[model samples]
Target: MKFNESLFDNEQTRKEFLQTTSALLISLSALSLLHCSEEAPQKPSKNLNWITTKPEKRPVMNVAYSPTRILLKNGIIIDGSGKPPFTGDVMINGSTIEIITPKQINFKGTTIDCTDKIIAPGFIDAHSHLDWILPLDGHPELKNPFMEQGITTTVTGNCGYGVAGFMPKSKYLAFIKNIGKGFFSGDSSTQKDKFVQKLAVSLTSMQQYLSYCRQHGIPMNMANLAGHGTTRMSLRGYESKPLDKDEMKTMLYHLEQAMDEGAYGVSFGLQYEPGIFATNDEIAEIAKLVKKKDKIVTCHMKAYSALSGTYPLKPFGTPHNIIAINEMIDIAKQTDIRLQLSHLIFVGTKTWKTCPQALSIIDKAIDSGLDVQFDTYAYHCGTSVINVFFPSSFLAQTPQIYEDKVALLKLRAQLELIVALLGFGYNDIQIINANNPELAKFNGK
Candidate 1:
């Protein structure tokens, strides 16, 4: 889930998720709007990157406007300054704010009585997967759940996985959208769906995809990141190998081209395929490219647990979560690029106490002049792709394990240990959307 408008507009939701979101310095949250207010307080050193920046002066575009524009009246204006809220009236001329004043302005146009309601800037979902709609030839549902939540802008192509790398199949879209057992319809016995029938979906390049989407119109404003996983997959499909000289050159060319085509930056899904296999050196090279472009880097770390991750599969002196933190920090330090850690969570039960240590590492890095920050989910519980909790080798050898009774028992034993380590049993993990029909009966059980 992305940070929607509810993070700012909806009081209960905000308080439910975060008692104080003061640490979201680098995020696209309305917290950035604090610096935009003339009455806003000075930016603190901890949030150094939140310094106010005045855009280059440019004339407003001369577009024809409707005579009667909507106006909001008698609303409590929350300027997002972390200051006290004030009562005010806001006048609008189309999407442009004509005025925001405490004193009443007598207007004859359509007026919306926002009495006792909050009038804040439109929210930005910095970690959105709206890029999931990339495969649709046309007709994007304008009234989707995001819009219902008052989110006007979204940062798409997050988690470094999307249609960016491959032509999305109906099953893939279904899986991402949580569309029931249809996503796992790999067998002939499954019901045939029109959605499953392949359609002509081209435009693999960043510019082409973006241009196509614009031509079709969108529900909200979006800034997309080129998926590092997708980029690797495009070049080498699921090949868990290091990049050679030629391949490195090609990858650079592809990434640079995406930036040039207006991708916001690069995102790394270190826990996911192609990205999981990515060597530190390879990641460094990509980060360096982002540094050259002066764009941001977002990463989903390799592991969030005490004893699991890509680094040596397990660490000796340090925990896997700490190693993951250092990995991103070191990348930022080396490349001097702005880095954002996506959904920083202590995965297993044993690692729950590692919170302070993780924050300490990040705090020290930021104190030392590194541009680093992170975001987290509201609750302690989470869900993940099955591969996350199991060894990749175990997943790869699934058929073999099933065939050997001893191996199957061993696998079950390992799962039990992992479950206990996670501080929850299999029962705690609710099946929101099971992929396979054979598993549909287990949903919500």
Candidate 2:
């Protein structure tokens, strides 16, 4: 059920799932290419002394390194500031690049011989889901997938599904239980249910998560966005309903806390559950809070379903891509918040041919004084939850509630709609994986 490219490139897949996209093209001739060390350098542990003592006394690394002079000789340097490549020697004093010149420099400490290799600043992964990936995989010391690719920093917690605040234990239990039903599986059974069950229970807040990363020694730096979906879940428990005044206040408080703790901004996965239930006004209210902090707002707009003309199931004209974009633009216009359109891409035949028109819309927005930006990958296929196409009514019910006769009948109807919306035969609907013994046989059929 995954739309390979869409899901991977989508904003908050990390909250529900993680995706991998293979780049098919490389711009080797580009003047600026990222280069990084093979591994992270060793630094004295700062928090080890407080491990068993008062946790409040634990020291976290928050300062830059003192000046240390090192020189690189004879390298092709491309300073990522869009400058042309030049052959030179670069000097580093402490954390800053002191100079880059063609002249030879006599220096103390280490001098690396770089006759052909490119020297450039580390790459910044503008978006990622490492917040959930690192904790789940327990590989903070070796974030090699990114490190090896020259990625020196990552901004995570995108798509309103961050791991910042805590959820009530009961809600956490229910969420975990629901995912175990294999509703989240991908190309394989994944058995994420077993993994989720085994995950250490202490990962409840963003601060604690970051502390874990620092304690484990992450190879790269990390930043975060407060997740709107997680906040909604914490308050409403996937009820698929609007928030009352008090609930909204609580959510705002959580967002404020996350921002004070260093969240760069906020994110929304309006295409998914909880967020899907959020009204335009509700989204605006949240974005207003983000604007108060003078931070950006990222959104996975409620566009695709509306564009496909399959959603608003009973109520047509429920804001498609153009409307969704306008809504975000309007929010930004009203609040003066920077807007980031997460993983912008055109989907389906209905929208694919209109790529030029889409770009024109964005261009017009920029011309109109709106601060808008977007990110995308070269891949075409996207991935998403198989149940995404399922109607909201079916989604609102808990897995336990779906075992009844009426619920089973509803499930059949929902499946039929999904098939019709897909407008494809069984061959196109390849079975990725299924937990049910009866359904597993259809894998790859």
Candidate 3:
């Protein structure tokens, strides 16, 4: 049909045209519009004559500044608050932002011309794991990769793995050493050795660890959480049962101390050992204290299993992720603790599509006056030690199981179960690394 093309002049007309078109013609029209849209406005050159009459001369200012103030002139300032960006000059006195104004202000200080630059606060990585990064060789400035992405603050000690607050007990240390000996191909002896030697003498508590991080001149600001797994280990060793009365007391005491020493909150890796074994009563005990102190409880809920759809063994019941979220919300309901759901996810084809419903559940809890928050990783996959998927008892016996044929068989059976549950064949699982030469063949398998 012959058409008046000017009907596409405005968005309303465009929509009408889209509705009247055949599918094949609509596709062609979309391609045509896409091609037309690819022409972007050309950026003006930095040395454009409108801004200057002559070629720019080399800057003559000294590379040093004696004044404790800095003036950033003529830039688009987006102050990190949700406010819209605007052109302004920002003045900093010492380390604090003293002023942001569109009008001229007289100031005797270093001036930086930010003609086309954007001035905004550094980004914050709300979930981070820096335990390994902090101990890496040569003390390379922290977060090189993250820095490239403009992140300047990191909240570490996430997912129940932290570097400090609990002493590396002799028995735990031996297990670590055994893992280093290739029982678990992922452990690095050198990395563990470095962490041990650096903190062995001076680091005893969360306060000490924070102090150590401060003293080390780490490039970015760091906030930490006291991990539930480490706290359980400190008090109950590698046991996978509920904490007894005295043991509970000790755990509570340490958590209180860590919060007082500047921990932002507490985190739990419920899918991992010891944390998975904590009873509802035990969790409530800790949540109560965190609520009392007005801190947060960040939990990686106990909903996930070795296989995506399988339920965790009882005491930690499961129908799915919804139950896990409800368990977390219940803590906030019972104790009024501020809750932060760490890495919230609904995996597997059966459950993955229910993310919106899961979120609605959280929203319903929030509507009922609970303090709830959540954060998630940006990527599609995650990394962890393979032992993380095993039962707590098996985890406790990892060192011995490596050499015991019966234990090895049991482990094999457990792995088979995981493979079946997750619907993974042998080729689906690839060892990240197997440092030992004898096991190198398994690395890419």
Measured against the true structure, the TM-scores of the candidates, in listed sequence, are: 0.73, 0.69, 0.70
Q: Write the per-residue lDDT of candidate 1 for residues 282-339, one digit (tens) a residue.
A: 9999999999999989998987877653444433357778888998899888999999
Clashes of each: 0, 10, 0
Better of 1 and 2 by TM-score: 1
Q: What digit string (tens of lDDT, one per residue) describes model 3 on residues 26-144?
A: 11111110012346678876543332212133122322344888988766677877776666677887889877765444555688887777778898888887644654444344447
lDDT of 2 by residue, 322-415 (tens): 6667777887778777889887765543344456656777888889998899886544444444444445555666454444545544544554
Ranking by TM-score, best first? 1, 3, 2
lDDT of 1: 0.62
Model 3, which residues run further than 4 Å from truth?
1-69, 102-117, 135-142, 167-195, 200-202, 304-319, 391-431, 434-445
Off by over 4 Å in 2: 1-74, 93-96, 104-116, 135-142, 167-170, 173-201, 305-310, 313-319, 397-445
Ranking by lDDT: 1, 3, 2
Q: Which candidate should be chosen as best, given TM-score against the real structure? A: 1
Local error of candidate 2 at residue 317 (angstroms)? 8.0
| Of 1 and 3, the candidate ranking higher by lDDT | 1
Q: What is the model-wide C-alpha lDDT for candidate 2?
A: 0.60
Index of the highest-lDDT prediction: 1
**TM-score of structure candidate 1:** 0.73
Question: Residue 97 in candidate 3 has what lDDT?
Answer: 88
